[model samples]
Target chain A: MTVSELAQLDDFEAVALPEADREIDGAYSGDLLSWVMGRARAGNAWITIMSNINVVAVASLADTACVILAEGVIPDEEFTATAQARQVNVLRSGKPAYEISLILGSVL
Target chain B: MSDALSFHYDVDGESFSSAGQASAGVKKNLRQLGIDPEIIRKVSIAMYEGEINMVIHAGGGEADITVEDNCIVIVLTDRGPGIADIDKAMEEGYSTARDNIRALGFGAGMGLPNMKRYTDEMNISSVVGEGTTITMKVFF
Candidate 1:
């Protein structure tokens, strides 16, 4: 699925749009940025509670299709702005990480 | 692209949120240079890991990325509490990052190992009280 489709899913909110359309081939749930950078494959939806700007960096580095801020973890204005500026797709969900993961699993 | 290109940035340690800016910038420049996506990923990931280390271990540092016809060299220099044991630090899962940093989702001891993993060559030079300088290269 494309990132736009993932954002348009039920209970999903698009916080920022990616600079370009990218294919979503998989998903990963991890808070450790470095580990995720090393492990997450290109085009995975990264599910995490991390809302910092560095999260955007990790997502970009790992080539994650999008960053889903789960469990109602809305990042600060600067962070979201940075995500948008970096052209990283960021989505927020009132649902927790596991639930979103399940939804992503089904959709993909 | 016959001539090598170099970019330098000062990493700010005050905010972990800002740690990877240098890496991100380098990635952008590399992409503009038309480097292979896989090679760019390797350099960006490795440099990003080193930037995180500079912030978490050393207060902040200087990051330099030089692109050559054959390879990209990354140099990180910081004046923080230098690593006491390179061997121990090199081991994955060995981290001395404070508890607070761990709370922020880092300090996994995977920094150096991951840097080494993504780069073709890595060298570390440190003085306990002085600082540490890591030089890494990714050959295209």
Candidate 2:
């Protein structure tokens, strides 16, 4: 499912993703940066609590469909810009990564 | 298979947060080559684990990536106190990392096994006082 569809399934208060030139396919969730770096598939959602800019680097490395910042975390200005530059969909949710993972697993 | 392209990286042992930089770089290069996502993931994940192991156990280390015709080989060499028992070290929940390393979201003892899991073949060689070297491969 797309991040848009996943957003609709739960009360996320999501930070809407900018319109992308490509379509999304799947979802992946993990807190371990290395695990996500290795396991996250391209065209998939990368939901995590990591707030560092390196997280964006990892997202780029994995070619993820989007990055969902869970648990009400906020990204630094550099992060949003980097994600945008990479054309990665970046979003934020009021809920935690675990809760978002549950909704995502069921929805997508 | 020949036509090997090699790359080298020095893992920083002091920084827990920077552990996966080499793996990240390799992932980007693989994507640019239009490699299969599954193969890329396997290579990246295995290499990431090995990188972290180097940072946490060894003071730091070097990683070499050789991309051949049909497979990618990653060699991670570290100067940490080597594993005494290879079999025991391979167990999933066995970790010798300090409490500090665990706080950084690693050292759950899955590093070695995870590397083995994602790679097509893995070889680990070490001496107790010397160091450890892990060589892993992912077929294209």
Candidate 3:
């Protein structure tokens, strides 16, 4: 499914959908930025509670389809601006990371 | 090599938020040079990890990237309190970073190992109180 389609889900809300049409090939759930950067596959929807500027950088470097901020974790204004500036897709989910991953698995 | 391209940046350590700016810049430069996506990914990840480490441990540093015909070389130098043991530092999950750093989604101790995993060659030289220099190369 495309990032835009994923954002349309009930549990997910689009925070920064700069690359809304990017396809979600898989899902990677992690909060550690370095581990996520190395293991998260390109086009994977990276699920995490990390709401920092570095999160935007990692999402951009990994080329993730979108960043799913689990547990309703909302990034600050700077993070949102950086995500938009970097053109990295970002979505917010009220569910936990595992639950978000399960939801992504069902759809993707 | 006369045909080689080189870029240099001073990593600012005062803010963790700006840690990966150098890596991001390098990624953009590589993309503009038409480097393969896969190679670009490897170089950027390795350099990004290095940049994060510099901020977390070395209090910032200098990153120099040299693009050759066959390989890309990255040299990171820092003058902070140096690593006492390179082997232990290379071990996954052995970081000395504070808890606050871990709260920021880093300090899992995977930086050096991940750097090695993504690069074709890596070398580290350090002194206890002096500084550390890490050189890594990724061959396209």
> Among these predicted structures, which one has the highest TM-score?
3
lDDT of 3 by residue, A1-108 (tens): 999999998999999988889999999999999899878889899999889888999999888889999998988999999999999999999999989878887898
Q: Estimate each model's TM-score.
A: 0.93, 0.79, 0.98
Which parts of model 2 have CA positions greater than 4 angstroms off? A4-44, A52-64, A77-89, A105-107
Please give the ranking of all candidate structures by DockQ, highest first, separated by commas. 3, 1, 2
Screening candidate 2 with a backbone cut-off below 3 angstroms (N, C-alpha, C), the clashing residue pairs are none
The candidate with the higher TM-score, 2 or 3, is: 3
Docking class of 3: high
How big is the positional error of residue B15 in model 2, measured in Å on the Cα after superposition?
Answer: 1.9
Give model 1's TM-score for chain A to 2 decimal places: 0.93
Q: Give the TM-score of chain B in candidate 1.
A: 0.96
- In angstroms, the error of model 3 at B35 is 0.6
Please tell me the TM-score of chain B in candidate 3 relative to the true structure's chain B: 0.98
Overall local distance difference test of candidate 1: 0.88
* Number of clashes recorded per candidate: 0, 0, 0
Stretches off by above 4 angstroms in model 1 are none
- Two-chain DockQ for model 1: 0.71
